[model samples]
Target chain A: MSSSTQTAQYNPAYHRFTLFLAICTFLLIVAGALVTSNDAGLAVPDWPTSFGSLYRIPPMVGGIKYEHGHRMLAEFVGLLTIILAVWTQRKEARSWMRKLGWFMLLLVIIQGLLGGLTVKMRLPWYVSTAHAMVAQTFFSLTILMTVFASRRWIGSTVTLTRHPDPGALSFRNLALLTVLAVYMQLFFGAGFRHGGLHFFPHVVGAGIATVILVWASFSGILRFGNIKPIRGASIAILGLLVIQLLLGFGAYMTRVVWGKDAVQPRPSMVATTVAHVAVGALLLAHCFMLAVQAYRNLAPAAELSPADQKAVVA
Target chain B: MKFRFGLLLILLVAGCSKNETPPASYKPEAPTAKIDPSTTATVSGVVTYTGDVPKAQPIDMSQDPACVLGKVPPNFGEAYAINKGRAANVYVYIKDGLGNYSYPTPPPATLDQKGCRYVPHVLGLMVGQKLRILNSDPAMHNIHSMAHENDGWNESQYPGGDAIEKTFNKPELMIPVQCNNHPWMKMYVNVLSNPFFAVTDAEGKYTISGLPPGTYTLGFVHEKMGEKTLKITVGAKEHAVAGPAFSSADIK
Candidate 1:
């Protein structure tokens, strides 16, 4: 196969790996839910240890189940990403792909350390929340890697007229704004997840950010008709926003639906918190998609001259 | 290939070192309390409330630099009663002269957060034993307990979460427990060598039972209220009443 064709080939392993990662991410999130649901934040008091003993598995107690389960899932994911990175290095010739593999490896290690620190430091809210944020980012980056590796996500050359379109900047701005807004929203969401509702402001701030995300999605969809994917992503974001909003309310109100008061949070909080995290992951993915779309539209391609290709090699 | 193989073998051997067990014949002493049993028996008391405690101030943990600007609730490190206008959640125990009875291995204990407050405002547990910390809220809460002896451990838990199980390797007198998430949520954990400690009731009364018929020093520890000590004699069959008249100011 020609280099271009070979590069373009639909690698089944890439798809399989992406799917595997997706499933694993889902399971990991569920494991996180179990951890939270079981109230097992500090089952292992020492970071990376159960009762100060390094080798002893944390007993399958309520908190231990969650905390240790989280640790185990993290290790599983770490190994998976290491394998994925190694596979990419072995099979991929692209420098970007190689760099991405290395980056993924670094991120997985950092993520693992962060998990340990969260335990060692007794799960400080900020560190704990940042730990969650990095996990979502890791998930998004892996998805991006999969996208780049897939045949459909081609870095295609596009022709545009010299006359600039008036709506181009708006689209660019909207894309950038969406990324920033979604990230900020996720940060606040992390605060909410880690703040323990003792701080009323964080609670209110998260609610406000959710509201803005909903509004931004609606407005972006209505205004950006030229960018189909942008509009689609916006609409999808809107839907997730609604679900998250309802999840929050359901978490708050449905205690009575389960024969409890509104003030009491239910097991649904675990699922809702996880879903909230997952949606944030999706938003980051969409942001990456928009960035790629924008970059592709603007970059000029000359079929990489032989000299450029040689330079890439060196 | 030989180098890599040799390195892997070395790593495997290194990992195997973790599995070595200690000599089985070596017997260890019973998990005893931190206090010297021979010293004057020091008495320590903790008062506990079964009802809700009113927040002296509103604690808000809404923004970054968590709890920086927010008002430190009156109970930041202090304990008080909420309903019935009675002081509850007080502690009075024997701190010195514990020479006769060694502190037992702390039995498994649970510190549950139900309705935004620690279920038992004052928890009594042994050194080197596990104590389960449970969070029943739907909100994220950070449990920051400042222990003088044990390495201070802090942790954040999501709601409907399981307990944060922890063990203090060393004995601690009175570690203040605070929720950094909720400045108002505060409690105390008293780590002792013996279970002879008792928390005071709403009536401002406390009692230490199971004394081994000897003279010992007694002490009381209350958050913000400080600690108190007195010498007392424990008879095998005599029931002893500590106090209802001790003032918070006096303890401080």
Candidate 2:
């Protein structure tokens, strides 16, 4: 069968809604950034309640706005995801997308529960990290949905011929290695972020990720005939890693500069933290590309080139 | 086979029962002494930092090479103070005489070691109360009580193991709870004279009750803070006194 026949067709409405969800997810991330930076997570001082009341009322109450506002936005994002997933259920095109949609819906709900648990548990580090990670994972799914639903990637296959070289196997291995390294590095980064094991480990993890990313880029270029997208992603990864490293250093050096407390927030501290978190999201995207490329190459090609197009296959 | 099975079942039940009993004993105990409900009075006030709540020094837990190698271990939050005689955190409460009234019990307390620090620098317990002192990290910790006016004991807990259940025999103004294994791990347990009294919050707020409707002198104190006295009379309704707010200088 042709690849297009075997592959699930893209649903435009579903694609649009998923993109919208992705946008909202980004906003929620930014809002969460603000919340963490401001230390507003505990500002309201109660879980599922604002100052002993169910909902926040305006003008006079402090902390209600930031805390409840993040909550309200989170609920809206959850609702959007549920709606998108349910709507796609009828389409039933790609079983994987449908499954992922349902999974995303379930994860979003669990993520909310985890958020409440964090408050209930008084911000235990592990639960808090899980909550942050679930958000990142959800964002990745939305990115995946956007990619699969797009006209460009749908029905496409990666081939060793397109990536043809004596080193196709090594390039493939390098790609898989890149994903594994990035993932482990991301996990360490998460630990450092949540465990509050600041500075040194973060630097070490970033430095390792940077080295692997550069090695992977050089390996990809040397082996894959200089595929621009892969090269570009590697370059982006390097740039982000460098910027993230500097931000980590900046977070330490300029920590007391704002003087909220040596432990508390300064503008620079807030900005750097948000940047650090955001870059992790971007790094995950680059890692996703590495995995996708590897998966595509593993599968047989359906679209024949000009030379092979005329031949009738047995 | 039948005879062996019977013996194994018997052993299993006995092992499970005894293993469960010890952890159940971890629950905190309310004071044995009680005050008459009719006589109980309440004293409450806000604690606020007027000048400055002295900035806590940042502990570079990573300062030690052993910590980086995950050997000597690091202090998670604040390390022990070397020269400072007055401890920063000591929650003083009454060890006895609080009439029974419904109150939210404190969260199951923990002394989690995260990235090598003991959370909650001070833990408050009633004189007859039980405290669950937990060790969260993978490091071995020995909880040592340096009690000046009360019985002192020290014990160690292995990583991922159960927290030790400890109680105080009598009231103590303040006692230093240290980790002998990790010198930097230090906490304070304040044993109260009356179960009715509690340390004020960060805002300097406290409530005391279960007093007979008569004038009694109540003292407000913290580890680093000196005593503030107030005379209170409880009528049909509980009495309230605005806790004395002191500048950081006044604390001395």
Candidate 3:
């Protein structure tokens, strides 16, 4: 259970590949956001084919670039996910990890179907919103797989043998709550972007999510700063939150204020809105990772009876 | 790595099999009956509004400098072109009572993109009639046809590019055409089976002449205010007046 012994279990190549896949997934998200921002969801008009040909590259002009570029990137990401799953199944010793890989594959396939449905159905608000939400989920899964394959996770497995700290347990619970709040806010944000829901709910969700995230990050830093993984993820989440807020404000100004009279999607509006969405995805992933790290590094206090707690303390 | 390459090959092959051809363009059949000018009646109307008219909002075309470099910026609030309570751009057409007597298709309709706005905000054309979409502005524009009944298309057109020729096969009430490059640029294209439709001009006056004598349902459609129908009986060589008044309550 020692750190040095756990190092033997770490697969650096697999971990690096997973991290690469996660980065690509994030880029795919950015591409998808650009497509929505440019209002080019139906630029190609057909699914699985761009302008009636899949192999032949269409003219990447105007909205077609954003729409077709997104599809190409998604295909690349889908290929990466397939490789990741197959590798995990063949090499990973953990049965749960293998299952997680296959689950990611399933999610990616579902994501692709939802994207096709969004286009074939002419961007129905619900289908488009669901496509956006599923992209977030797929990105989070990649992040989770990346975290699971990290050396830190392997080394921290020994923490399970130590006595459960009640404070860390509460912090873990708070991190989980923060993750849920961030996800709910993302749902509202997707709904607003797709025109299914009004902006009021998204704004309100942002306020609530910000409050909970700030509380969780500050508490994690103040109480669990000694834990490397928890402190690192908490600090990253706080930094991402600041950038996300500024981007959100810029998006609002560009989209609602300056962009009100714009005949077309302005470069500034598209940039800021896409950045806000990208940062929102990053914030969600970081929040989820923080929760996962807390759970991995700190055992739940509820699992220990009073006698067992006393014995462990002694 | 070999497995990954093999999997990629499989995906590429799998994608090759899904060759879905684009839907065929709809073409309307030629008219069967000829119109008699001597027996035809005229339907004229003044589209008047009873409620407060929405103020015209100034459009900011600064996003695309070419939109205002040498041209006047269009008014975004053209959605409600009301002059002293008279509404312009209202599409008044025969909704019913044509009795399957088809009329000859009219000449091609032109939807020009000048100053980053559709020249005619609202237009009506016979089904299967050619629609020439021209981009006269210096900036790039994408013409997106949001047609529910017909095939939808989104194509980008460069400034001074060749005109895009399109035709609708079915009689759809209205198909919204927009330029995604400029969100403020929008126009409605109404396709009809017969040539008995007219759009109200600046004075809110619309005249639809050469209609065969018959009982017809006149449909007045405003972009914001939903459709209003009126039953009218037109006599031969007679001029029928359709004074359809749309109020704020009719806003859809």
Candidate 4:
């Protein structure tokens, strides 16, 4: 009964570390985008090492800069994930969250191996595309952790118990659906990038994703726009999606259309395409946060907020 | 649902199975031309502009943050640059009316991106002459050519990247080169078949040599002002300076 009564305590250090991991994930996603944009996936042409050395000797310029730089950043994030997992295992009170920490550490390690395997295997379409998908997932997971560790989320129960707002199923359902739609689009994007002949489908999928995401974001905003956290997440999701749409169109023109005749170092093409790909990670993270917020707000028939109990008892 | 997803994965892999392979032993033909040295004359002149000179406006490099990796490029907008009563960046060449007298193509010309701006804002090359593009800045530079006559190409070169080797197969008067990454970065390249072209410098002076002694129509092209064609004769061993200062009134 005491365990049931005890509210989740806010841990500022854990929250800060979770935020750091989220930022790192975002940077890693951007770095990965640069590698693909510069066509530098094979620039280093070696795995787990640059040019067969631990140190990038003689210093590579151009494409290799992006490739090697991405590797270094990813490794740093991988180390950070391990440290976070160990800390969470030791200090975190929630059993499910602790397991999640360990699972995320496992995901980061697998992601690291995929990064190396992608390079060593000469960027096979399957492996490379999977690597990109995993990156989005890992980034989303980091965002989930960031949301779960937030001051707002830790004090969520108190707000729900006092405010007694209706648990709108529309927002919750839309949030869950948005996550699935985003993952599907990311898979298509990965295949499209690798020339997996999924470009046509990917383009169509983008159109569908735009509609679904807009609807979902609108639904959330309509239902719980009064709440600060929900409003912020909803607006961010919509804004990032709009940016992603513009970048996607720009990328298509420069890369898919002008790509055939383009000379080396096509500047505008790379930037637009990279932004398009990287924004997906941001959108995915936002969607996952929206889902977590929805879950926090909507619970039916069991373990109702104290305010809900008050209504029932009266 | 799981089975369908697995099938889609297999379909994706199979669809991407097609691999690209370069053509074997593919090489473009070498360029060759015969220059008639007999009775050849030179054309020289000062390209003065009669208009209000537009001052150089500072270029906004806000789009590409890395443009300032080295030294920042000075202001752009050289549409009409005049100093001491002389026009710079005036393009002059023999537009037409030369009969079948071919000249050997010169060596490749160089266009460098030093401070996120192309050094020598305008350059000329023989149709088959190579263009060596280098990125001297620490940021990335891409060359996107919008040419109506020659084949258009877009190339990317990171800082310290290998020099790009490119060539034009047809005569194009002015090919607009765009740096797509840094939208403001732009340069013009002129490709002609004959080696009878020159752009004016700070003093607004240019000389066209290796011209066969004959009457030919000389053309002047300015970036913003307009273009002009004037009939001129290259008398035997004559150094015909272009007469009549080019004024903005003549610009359409």
Candidate 5:
């Protein structure tokens, strides 16, 4: 997670493009949520074409509009990821960053193919849920790129490695565990959304993810309280986590509080669900940023003083 | 950067639009049609079954006694109602050979849910025809229309709620509408591209009128039984095909 030595010679424009890609990927995730919530999977009925037409000459109204628009946004994001990969390969001074770009591009390509498979397979429950799950991972990758390319992250020097306090848990390890748990919860959320068996567990998984995230945040505050990046991300993650919880309950209320009358989704339900999805992406990204920061700021026991490190065990 | 952000905003705005509203109780009024009385013909037939069909299953209504209150106890949703070897609830219609003849949109067939069962076990309507599903029970009922050949929709209707009206945009032989809450409540709806179909009455009788002169394929279908077809030609006036009567042997 430490910035590459060559990162000193950075192209500001490249950094900006990375941020742009991150934002684009975020939007794409939200668009995907809208499509699923609207149940517009069969609106277009055909892939790579809208009713046998190349363009939307006949404007799509209603459900077809949502399905087709998602396709367009996905295509655009795919192109942007491709450009980001090639652009970094051509101009980036650091090899790791360039490879990160390529990794993102590869993930996006796989994601697009999965999306196409979802359509071709007639929107089977498993394929559709996989599509949702991959979007989240792809979103994580884009957010990682943004975190790596940030000026604050690249400008800082990490000569002195900050290990956790004696007898305290490793900050880096805690964050890594938090990220994995959050992603697991996201996977469960995807299953829940698609009407699968993991629904109740998904609800329970939220509580587990929340506890882990808060623990990681507290550890971050205790160990790197004075550091601006750790302090800021911790606060942001905590705040976003609260908002996400509220949105999740609000979504459940509007979606399933009524038993037999749960067929039609009100506009409020749509808004809450979409917002919950967006906030989830944001939370995952924030958690990942914390993980990256942990790796950069905190080193293994060997990097600390021998007496202090002796008090800490792996 | 500002320009790029603005462009992103524009793209987002362009991508999102209002979602299609749920089924509303609005039925298109049927317009007057121009059927040439001279060339119009009629096709009539009877669907007779020859076998000891299984007894209609007893529908349990204890989950919601409101579904069976004041009604006959154990009044099951009759699957097969045959009278003296004549099968009822058979849907008879023209399968093919009718050249371009457009009919006016008829009013939606009302599928009422009373006593926790669909009033009519079988209903038939033309493509683009409206269907109004009413929930007469003092409980919540959801209409889950399962169609393979056309779009399927599931909507909920509360007691005393307005009827949920919907129309099929394509032709499907039969769409099963079920109440997810009351498992025993079920109905089958047949959607045809044209209004040349009829359901057999208790006497296994059907008559499809207002047909233009042409050779046609007639189709007969029963809810829990089977389907059969016939080939016939109709000339001017009320022409009836000779006794190409349909028997249970013809049902596959």
Candidate 6:
């Protein structure tokens, strides 16, 4: 089948909306990071409400600005996710895509619950760490959905069947491994933030994840540079990796070196730490996107089962 | 001879009456000794530091403009609160030797958040004594107690909000209380079983009075200097002086 045949199920508006939701999710991650960086997780004290009222707007002063603002943005993104899921279910032709839509909804619901639990339990390390991990998962799912719905993804499916690359499977494996490494690193980072894990684990995980990410990105560029989706994602991940490392160092300096005697959370500390967390989320999402693209567009058709083949075309 | 016999019989009867047991309703009087200042002992001490004091670092309250609205930003690196050679904010308490004597809870202690700082940074209160937290600044504050032995709690207080009254049910030494909104606002609450504890003032002077005369382990705790203990014997109506000298090497 040609690209045009596969394009029938692709909705341009839905594709754009998915991308928009993904961006919003990234922003929400930033806001959430701000809350942690400022230690404002318990500023509002109540879950699902600011100062015991759902409708009443509490004065956004001090930590409330970061915490309550994060909640507001989170609610907006939740609404967006709901619309995206419902729209996908009603309009998408693929059963797997519809399932994915519902699954994303479920993940988002769990993410919100984790958020509430983190606050209600007064920022328990486990719950807060879970909240951070789930957020990254939900964000990665959004990115995956966006890539799957793109025009590039539709055209690549047809093109890959005609010209099969034997190294595609290895590349896909490498990408997946990079995803796991990055996700584990993020878990350790979140654990460190919530005081569940020590800083040593996070630091060690960062080094290992960095090596894997660099190797995977280089492999994608060297072997599959012609593939736009794979190359683009690889480049994005590489760029974000650099920025992440620098932000990580900046965060460390502000939090440990310069802030050693700080009486309060300094603005620089909050800024650097929040940016580091935001960039880390973006890096994870992009890494997952690369893995998905490699799996769907680079892998040989013979390796896919009949169901997988049908889902790919659909 | 008859009168002498009568006298001897009378004397024998009196001696027999003295040897007889008392009535069932008869009870002896209670002891008059109590835990009064005149009868009890006082522990007076000065916490002195022999090493160089850490200089205070200027706090950056620019994150919240309300924290520095009209007042100058304060420096806070001095974790030991050393002035001249004396240490302020040192919690001096009778750590041991009060065997079975129970004490009533003291009056409620007040901790205020003013200028984005905790007033009376180190406080000692008896177990079950109320702690009234007030926000005197125009900024919002959340009091988060990081208690290990007691139940931890976090509550928000808006600007000009009502005072938050809390009581610790267990004896927890040095429970850290922090304002998450204003991270610089920190305090340590010492929940003690007895009322014989005092925090050193600016001059490093502390007097723990009304202590029953006995040998005790006087504990001196600082936020950064770890802890030091002294063995002292207190006599009735005596003022026992126990001065603990902390060195910079003791900083932990």
CA lDDT, every prediction?
0.58, 0.58, 0.81, 0.74, 0.72, 0.81
lDDT for each residue of candidate 1 in A1-314, tens digit (9 for 90 to 100):
12433354457887679668756866776676555443456555556565556666733433455676677778888888888888877777666777778887887786676676666556556666766767777777777776666655543312221111134344445556666666776666666666533435545755666665665566556544345545666777777667766765554443223412112123465565556566667767667666555444322224433332221000
Q: DockQ for every model, please.
A: 0.06, 0.04, 0.19, 0.03, 0.03, 0.24
Q: How far is B74's C-alpha from truth in model 3 (Å)?
A: 11
TM-score of 4: 0.55
Number of colliding residue pairs in model 6:
0
Q: Interface Cα RMSD per model, in Å?
A: 11.7, 15.7, 6.1, 10.3, 13.4, 19.6
lDDT of 4: 0.74
Report per-candidate TM-score of chain A alone: 0.76, 0.80, 0.91, 0.89, 0.90, 0.90
lDDT of 3 by residue, A108-179 (tens): 987897788776556767678878877998898899899888887765565544335576348778999988
TM-score of each: 0.57, 0.55, 0.72, 0.55, 0.58, 0.87
Q: Is candidate 3 or candidate 4 better by DockQ?
A: 3
For residues B1-252, could you state the per-residue lDDT of candidate 3 as single tens digits? Answer: 366346434544433432355555555555567777899999897999988765555666665567777765454658888888899999999999886576667889999998878999999988789999998887777788888887777776768999999988788876888775566678899988788899999999999989899999999998889899999999999998986899978765
- For candidate 6, lDDT tens digit of each residue in A1-314? 34334544667999999999999999999899999988888878777878889978877777788889999999998899899889988887666777889988887887787787777667768678878988988888888888778877654555554213355447788889988998898889889888898889888998999999999898878877766778898999999999999998898889977887677677899899999988888899888888877876655657665544432210
RMSD of each: 13.1, 16.6, 6.8, 10.6, 15.2, 17.8
Candidate 5 falls in which docking quality class?
incorrect
DockQ of 6: 0.24
DockQ head-to-head 2 vs 3, winner: 3
Point out the worst 10-residue segment of candidate 1 chain A by lDDT. A157-166
TM-score, chain B only, every model?
A: 0.66, 0.63, 0.87, 0.81, 0.81, 0.84
In candidate 6 the C-alpha lDDT for residue B239 amounts to 89
Error of 2 at A215 (Å): 1.7
Query: In candidate 4 chain A, what residue range of length 10 has the lowest lDDT sum?
Result: A305-314
Candidate 5 per-residue C-alpha lDDT over A1-314 given as tens digits, one digit per residue, 9 for 90 to 100: 24455445556887888888888889898888887776556555455665567665334443445677788989999999889999888877678888888988877876776676555444546556767767887888887777677676666654444654433567777888878887787778777787665568879998999999998888777667765667777888899999999998988887766311323234676788899999988888888888878776667766667544433222
lDDT of 4 by residue, B165-190 (tens): 98887777768886645545667898
Q: Between 2 and 4, whose DockQ is larger?
A: 2
lDDT tens digits, residues A113-140, model 4?
Answer: 6776665444557778878887998889
The order of the candidates by lDDT, greatest first, is: 6, 3, 4, 5, 1, 2
